[model samples]
Target: MSSTISDPASDGVVRAADGTPLKQRLNRALRREKLRSFLLILPLLAFIVLSFIMPIADMLFRSVENQIVEETIPLTVVALKEWDPASGEAPGEEVFAAFHADFVQAFKDKKHTRLGLRLNYDEPGMSGLFRKTGRPSTKMQPPYKEAFIKVDEDWGTVETWAVIKQASPAYTDGYFLNAVDAHRTAKGIEMVPENERIYLFLFGRTMFLSIVITMSCLLLGYPIAFLLASLPLRSSNMLMILVLLPFWTSLLVRTSAWKVLLQQQGVVNDFLVWIGLVNDADRLIMINNQFGTIVAMTHILLPFMILPLFSVMKTISPNYVRAAKSLGANDWTAFWKVYFPQSIPGIGAGAILVFILSIGYYITPELVGGTSGIFISNRIAYHISTSLNWGLAAALGTILLALVMLLFYVYDKIVGIDNVKLG
Candidate 1:
């Protein structure tokens, strides 16, 4: 029997007396491992860029993008460049000729309506004026300022010229300004009329609701998490199922259930009536209001709080509390000093998660939230799909995203992100 002895370095790896080849091989191995790790994570990295980063970048870009007037009325854009706003008079004949030339072609190309709508953002009645003037623009001759005035005397005003000049820029801060309940005027940026300002109120309401929902979740989830963590494994597993059962249900289904339960004529009202807490004739207005949104959202997000708290609390040793008590501390004092502080990591994680989720929620608030409970997300959706005001929608979305990021920054500063415990 012929036996072959295997050599450790038989694969032709070279080695120097100083072990330089060994170090080179180790470096190569480390590089190979790093490459493998990068390859493994590449797909996830690409997915995040495409799905999250790209959309946010696009939305932020669109918020400041204003090319409608410049693109649709090229001649007018050029003409307005030299026409000074300080002149305090209507545009001159040369400016009118350039505008009339562009306006006629825009009318012929069926772009007048779009240009009109774009300009109308700066001045509300401009759309009607443009729409009415489209047909008559074809009939106008030279000295077009007089012709334009004949079509609509408002076009003769310096304010109309100012609006056109303001909108002619390819990029603008108007959308962002408008989003915060402010507008650009001849003087400078100023607040919108008090009656017309709703965005600030909407933002306030969204933050208020988000805070209330987060607090509600904390109050309800903390005790349950403590119970789950303190119980035996078998009992904890059973109780955990009860907490997680909501996760298995469809979100829409759960929200609809809340709708049914909270409706004026629904089970909750009937129960109140049966208990003589409320009369049948005076059912509570719970659904389609802020109360319904808060109740439904709190129920939906409670699990998020519970899971984090339970994870942290389960790892906490009972001996800490016992030791505190043996040292002359009461039950409440032991818990407050030893237990609750440890659980704060979980609280920070859960509160931030619930607050972030609640602030951006749409469907739950939409179905239950009548006019009063609607969030800024609802308005963003409205501008995106209904009004076709994409720039305005993007601005609103950017503002909300900024608010979330600001909250995250504040949380990080206060709680320290590294201290937040997920498990």
Candidate 2:
């Protein structure tokens, strides 16, 4: 009779049965497991690449892309290729003639001048140039040797052509420079004037605000988290629900409620006055400032800090502190040296979360701080919605994103983000 035999490589038994070699069968099983794991993770990998990586790449492209210039003045750009800026003489009239034709065509097209104006607005006074180029007088004139010059006398000046020439490139760092309160010149880079230098100041203020808010949340949330973690299960569950109650409310509602409560004529001020704590209600300045922003944001983000800390503290047994005390370490020393070090992961996680969220906060700062209280994001919003400067807006956004990423990198280096466990 034929006996069954195992196919060692395939982990399959033959009709002439015999056992497979252990190593080969184990390798086959491992290969199957690896294949199954890959299949299970394939969808997630595809989702991350398509949704996260691709969109970020596109945003980075937009941040540096200068399509308006490339599309608007193709002819002028071609004509000026041989023209040298250092020559100190005007480019040939052919350059002007090409620009004149382009301008006339753009005016006729109605929307074309807008592209030039938008591109030029980054450099200032380009809008006026577009307006002059679109004038009826320039449009009605017949072609002549000086017809281009007649369109705008300034067009002949080397300075005007130089601006146009410099802007002809497909990509530019102009927006990025401007966002950082700096700009490029013919000579090279230079600092912007103090009066107009808003971004650097705003960036500093945002960082300061984020740091303060993060610290405050840590100080206030740590005790509460400790209490929740140390308590029995039933009590901890009820307290956690209370702590998380803010999460159920909309952020906007919470901020608005603070505004009503903290206003000079609001409940808090009235209570203080009723309790004889303050001399005047007007002294209770709450809305339209940094204090309001910090208070509202701290309240909203406190739960984030608390939850992670509670999880970490819960996993840490009280016996460690007791064991330290038994070994002659004082209560404060034991808690500080033993417990605090272990909770670093939670601290890092909470701080990173709060700092990142604080940097991007718009509505709270806008509503509470008003003009003086606005952060970098408010300026970004204005540039996008009102000024219609996508380049500047994108540049500002890119800078904010970079700062947050840098913070993450630093935190990861210091505390090893890979080791951070939420539970």
Candidate 3:
């Protein structure tokens, strides 16, 4: 027999050629793989942080920032610290003198417009009030309280000073309060007058419309998804082309097409006239209303609902339904009892996606939603562009972001995030 030799590597302690342990060599291999994977994803990670994360962080910071008053009226802010509006005492002569100097400087620097705009959010009409008073500020002399009151008797009241005092801080929740349709008063936070409380209504309408659109998409998409999943391969592929055709078209183009199709004198009304459905003189009011929003959004988002349901339904074995039917179960009973529960993951995924997208929609609503049907996102855009009230816009955006995150949290808890499938 040939001499048998024991290999040191096989006995118990394996080693690399240079005598390094095999365990260390394997760990080094794993480390290389981890580094390579991280390197491959670094660019995408950086992009997400810079584009999505940073902007949202900046908006959250801007929501609570309140520097307009402190910057414009530095001396007035300092002088008002000792004064108490709740004490029912007017600020003394020194406070008036300091305010006079600060207001004059602000006027000369052309910062009065910004100051007025900021204050007007807290106390309406302050913009015009400041613009009117700023022009005559130079004519006022010492014993300035009387002279300032002459510019506007409202200046002598404690209520006016209370607004100024509340706004003195460099950072505050005043914008958030305004976003919720409340005001900071001497007593504390209180709701604005009934006529002025519109933000809460807009928020409620946005959520309501979003739910309606999601439900509409579900109702229309379920049967189509089932048909697509159940049909023969060639037919399913052809139908899928139609379902995905909208993605090839521009969103603006689709919205504009709807506007043309739904207008009073457009194809829909003209067809109704031709069919003698009703008199041609009184065409239905469809576009630029809630009906238009619901219809357009349902069409645009229907594919999202269908794709998820189709992905889930395609994986479901037909044998389950066949087995149930062989056991004397009706088609409806088999589907409701056996098929629907398994398909719920798709429903949750699609509903959350559609609802979230609908809440933040601006261009669609702006294009077709008239004043009555406009969303809260439209209001955010108005404040951002037309009103130039970035603080309020940021506050509104932050609130909306919070709401979306809360929905995701709830969905994750109820359905388990792992169950969400988006093929």
Best by TM-score: 3
**Lowest-lDDT window of 10 residues in candidate 2?**
9-18
lDDT score for candidate 2 against the true structure: 0.80
Quote the positional error of residue 42 for candidate 1 in Å. Answer: 2.8
Off by over 4 Å in 2: 1-53, 137-152, 280-283, 409-423
Which tens-of-lDDT digit does each residue in 1-423 have in candidate 1?
A: 112433245555555455456659788889999999999999999999999999999999999998888888898889888888888888899899998999899998999999888778778999999999999999999889999999999889998899999998889999999899999999999999999998889999999999999999999999999999999999999988998889667899999999999989899999999999998898899999899999999999999899888887888999999999999999999999999998998888789888988999999999999988899999999999998889989999999999899888877875676866532
- Candidate 2 residues 1-423, lDDT tens each? 123543444444332223555557778889999999999999999999999988877767877887776676678789989898778877886776676677666777685557656656556766776776676534544443266566667666677667777778889888888888997766678878889999999999998988999999999999998899889999899888888788678988998999999899889888888888886724588778988888888998898789877877888988899999999999899999998998887787788878888999999998898666788999999998998887888889889989889988877885577765442
Cα lDDT computed for each candidate against the true fold: 0.89, 0.80, 0.89
> How much does candidate 2 score in TM-score?
0.86
Q: Which pairs clash (backbone N, Cα, C closer than 3 Å) in model 3? A: none
Task: Give me the displacement of residue 155 in model 2, in angstroms.
Answer: 2.1
RMSD of 2: 4.2
Q: Candidate 3 residues 42-145, lDDT tens each?
A: 99999999999999999999999998899999999999999988789789999999999999999999998789889899888788878889888988889999
- The reply for model 3, stretches above 4 Å from the true place, is 1-13, 410-423
Global lDDT of model 3: 0.89
Q: RMSD of candidate 3 to the true fold?
A: 3.2
Error of 3 at 132 (Å): 1.8
Clashing pairs in 1: none
